[model samples]
Target: MSQEIQNISPIKQRILQFIAELGRSKREFYSLTGISRGTLESKTGITEDTLTKLFTAFPDLSPIWVFTGKGEKLQSQQNETSPLFTVNENIEDKLLNIIAQKDSEIKALAEEIGKLKQEIIQLKELLLK
Candidate 1:
């Protein structure tokens, strides 16, 4: 509710503040939303094509909320059984695979470090003789 935003139309204000919060340039918003310049221009009452370009460029927004503000701030829906929840299953599996691999690596490294420490201790004992 800053003074600058208070004066503008609500839709344009939401778009502008959302962009600023996302910490990205307008060009990035254009790429993210895939929204046409004309579409954005018609909705926000912003005459500058560059203004509309902001929506498409930013990645973190839910296009639904950005376009109509009718849903959650993010793209997630309310229904617990929505298919969208499973949309990233493959990506999640890949991440778990990577984490498992890293865990194995860490276990091996810890074992090696233990062996090295024992060797150091034996060497120190020899020196003490």
Candidate 2:
């Protein structure tokens, strides 16, 4: 029930801070960022894959800060600005859940697209016969 992460590395600590500042839930962070809760909690250091997932999920987050504790927390023309999207605290969990759901939907759609592409190729081959 607690969002508290144990055995967290500094980078992971910063990641938790970023997620907190975003007004998002740990489930949402895990779902959208593709970083498992276990990995974030247990890993002692950041990896290229972790950084990629983090940056991809939250482009506004400053890589420099995530990596070296330097620069603003956000990256923009004026870095002092707030998060791009604001969620009502009452509905924050719901909205994040929806985001996670959407991510799953997108992945499913991508797989469907790949299947469709294969079907199309087969159809073309049949037509050529």
Candidate 3:
């Protein structure tokens, strides 16, 4: 673990531990949480917005456990045969959903940038007239 991860706040440490438990890379956690790379890696504390997104993106995660780290990582039943407790497919689905959302956001941003560029061109034309 890096010194930065070691020095992070309690909640952040929990988040880091969660990430480690999942065996996911930092990039994967940032993608899943919709948290920016800089904020995810550099911040000492986890913001509410990031926490909200994290829970929303991964509903299987136990918020209580994430906040306090005193209980099971998941809130579902302990039985391995239970669908509620299954990990692999559910995690993959959640990650896919997050990736889809990011794709949509990127598309929207691209469209907005195109509109802004057109407006800039129109303003330039008016100014040059």
Candidate 4:
């Protein structure tokens, strides 16, 4: 209910919210939903194509809620199943992924710095008589 979420169309907001709930990468969402990265960004409401793709990927989700802003967000589960991923697990997984990427970036930067330092030493030696 922040200003940003309130500004966009309701359906788009729900889709984005669902994406965060899924704890999956945008790349994965695009692959599964068959919608491109900017599809939600540009669209205000659900289209037939988007609805079909969304439902196909997420059968548990409530299309009525996503499309019309009516009813529960999820389809009622007769079997009383757990969510696809626990909220804590989703957050933990995202944090871990971020840490891994940052670690890799730091390593690459360290290697580059070492190379630059060595080049500086070599240049200094060459300039010294």
- TM-score, per-candidate, Cα-based: 0.34, 0.52, 0.53, 0.50
- lDDT by residue (tens digit), candidate 2, 21-123: 8899888889988886766777477788888998998888888888788888888733546553456555777678779879999999999999999999999
Per-residue lDDT over 55-115 for candidate 4, one digit per residue giving the tens place of the 0 to 100 score: 8999989877887877778887334465434466677787777788799999999999999
Query: Candidates' lDDT values, in order?
Result: 0.64, 0.80, 0.79, 0.80
Better of 3 and 4 by TM-score: 3
Output candidate 3 Cα RMSD: 15.0
Model 2 residue 124 CA deviation in Å = 80
Backbone clash pairs for candidate 2 read: none
lDDT of 1 by residue, 70-93 (tens): 776555443465343345569887
Which residue pairs of candidate 3 clash?
none
Ranking by TM-score: 3, 2, 4, 1
Q: State which candidate, 1 or 4, has the greater lDDT.
A: 4
TM-score of 1: 0.34
By summed lDDT, which 10 consecutive residues of candidate 4 come out lowest?
A: 77-86
Reference-based lDDT, residue 39, model 4: 76
Segments of candidate 4 deviating more than 4 angstroms: 1-4, 78-129
State which candidate, 2 or 4, has the greater TM-score: 2
lDDT, residue 93, model 4:
84
